[model samples]
Target: MKRTWIKKSLLVILLVGILFVLAGTVYLKMNTYAPSEAALAVAKTGKSEDQILFFEGEQGKPAIIFYQGALVEKESYSLWAQEVAKAGYPVYLVATPLNLPVLQQNAAEAIIAEHQLTAVVMGGHSLGGVMSSRFVSSHLDHAIKGVFFLASYPDEKGSLENFSGSVLSITGDRDGVLNQEAYQEAQRFLPDQTVYEVIAGGNHAGFGSYGEQKGDQSATITNEEQQTQISQLLIRWLENLE
Candidate 1:
């Protein structure tokens, strides 16, 4: 009788431990993430990143290629990508090199050669926009249908003579990182073909990662709101493009 009682007690303890672990796992997953979720998730290392050829958009339209901000990983752009994709165009988010050596430019060169990119639209946030400009300027081809500048600084390092393509420049009314006056002045010199969109109360870091981009911890808005606003504006602007 003593041995029987001990065995029953141990079994109850073991079952309780298993139930606790299962409950903890479920709670974690509820707060954390799942693979199929559209939010950004990191790509594993050691796997060959795929080529930049065209990704299929809705209704057979051309795709938009998204370039990520400096130090902002590709996973961080996944939410933005899905929003754009929902607007009838699929999105390809490219990884910029650590050195930032016009890496996407090289990727574009290879991608353009292999893919039948019908109407390419390039857009990026902050430094990523600068890199996109570099890629478009060097390519010198009409394959790029248009360009979107998201809280970005124009290419001051190079002459803006070659950026004659359609431009959609977006900056928040309260953006501190990008010089609005400088961007406006630069737009004036660009052959009179640029459009600017300003979001009220939106700031500079609102353009990128929620935590990583907000070093000062002084950001005034949530990432979900910013992503929704920016993505919606981009889609509406792209739709207006001829």
Candidate 2:
């Protein structure tokens, strides 16, 4: 009877593992947003290959490296990067492994090194933002000047409470995926000069090109409107870093 029970337990574990794999596959397929013409167009402004969208600006100028949110295609945040690049600095929309930023924590390092970006700022949307904060904190010796978050905040695991550089935190008022308690608490971890902006009537998915995200409130603004607002905000903040 003991042997029989052991076999049954193993079988149950196998079934559960298979179920989890299937769920993950489905989730990834459903969430990966395709790059649009506008996004490609922006990429063409510099280079579009190797899963890295580059909007080239003045050489040696500071660059902004962006991380992709969980299960989100890297191109989803191209709109913001494009706008920043137009403002002067090259913007890199880093493609993380398995579309998860946490899995590729040091991905930004390679981009910054290979591109010869002297001064850099890191940013992202949602989980991307959280991971970017973690990267900057761990690599404090690197020349990263600051961090930006869209519809996201750093948790204790990636807290920036003692970070000395500039930080920008932008969120949509209607963001349902963002934890209200955590975001409010994150203020304590950021520097006093952190720039926080709340986009009126915006939602979590508004920061990316992906379709409506599950558990997120519907946005009162169109995707273009929301993205444009974020773009302008990023432009102003990054330019100030000059």
Candidate 3:
């Protein structure tokens, strides 16, 4: 009986050791399987590498998922995302590899599941913001923390209804590319709660990482200043919300 007891104890110890090894191997494998290629392929639906950029942060603040403008790539938004991460908020870029409309929604749901986020605040640059706004309006029951837009229109893609969520719109005062007509039109949807900020000398591409590629030739603010101001504004707004 004593020998049998010893054998069972050894067997249990061996099983536990094997389980630990298996768990460690799975973790290592998952860490090695990055989705850069899958993300790039999704970006090709309209543009490559336009969907998501991941950044490490303080892990308590809600994740900030950025959706880029129609023609911009995901890498172009990394500068702003990195700045947000530095401020202690995790950030991810939302892409549209399969399709902009579908992928953005899918990305949000998938990220929420992966991170176990009960309430995530979503935003984007230009059309990306538009997409996020539309999404949050419909998914408000999911406990979205807030919604923001960088040089993005407020209305839905095909309709006149205002986007759902705590809307924030930022644009450069000197940005001729972001038509004021559209801005005003979008405002009609959010009567009192929307926060619209216009940075002096900023441009339509203020949220992007690169400025020379846009070829507007009229921007008054340096890219660094624009990026900083944008990041600060986002952080302030995020800190104030419920």
Q: Residue 211 lDDT in model 2?
A: 73
The residue-by-residue lDDT of candidate 1 on 1-242, one tens digit each, is 99999999999999999999899767644433122232434222112246332234585555677676655555555665566776788677676554242555555555556556777887777777777777777666657777887887456543346666678878776666676677766664344577778876677666654343333234466666777888898878778774
Best by TM-score: 2
Sort by lDDT, best first: 2, 3, 1
Best by lDDT: 2
User: Model 1 off-target regions past 4 Å?
Assistant: 1-38, 41-56, 99-104, 156-164, 212-217
True lDDT of residue 66, candidate 1: 64
List candidate 3 segments past 4 Å from native: 1-51, 98-106, 157-165, 213-217
Q: Estimate each model's TM-score.
A: 0.70, 0.86, 0.71
lDDT of 2 at 219: 95
Query: What TM-score number comes out for model 3?
Result: 0.71
Q: Model 3, 1-242: lDDT tens per residue?
A: 99999999999999999999899767644432122333344323322233445776676687776776765656666655666777888777765653244345546777777768875888877767777776676665786777787877657442224435466778877775666797777776553677888888888766675444344446687777887898898888877874
Across 78-136, the per-residue lDDT of candidate 2 in tens digits comes to 77777777778788888876788888888888887887777998998888998998888
lDDT of the candidates, in the order given: 0.63, 0.83, 0.67
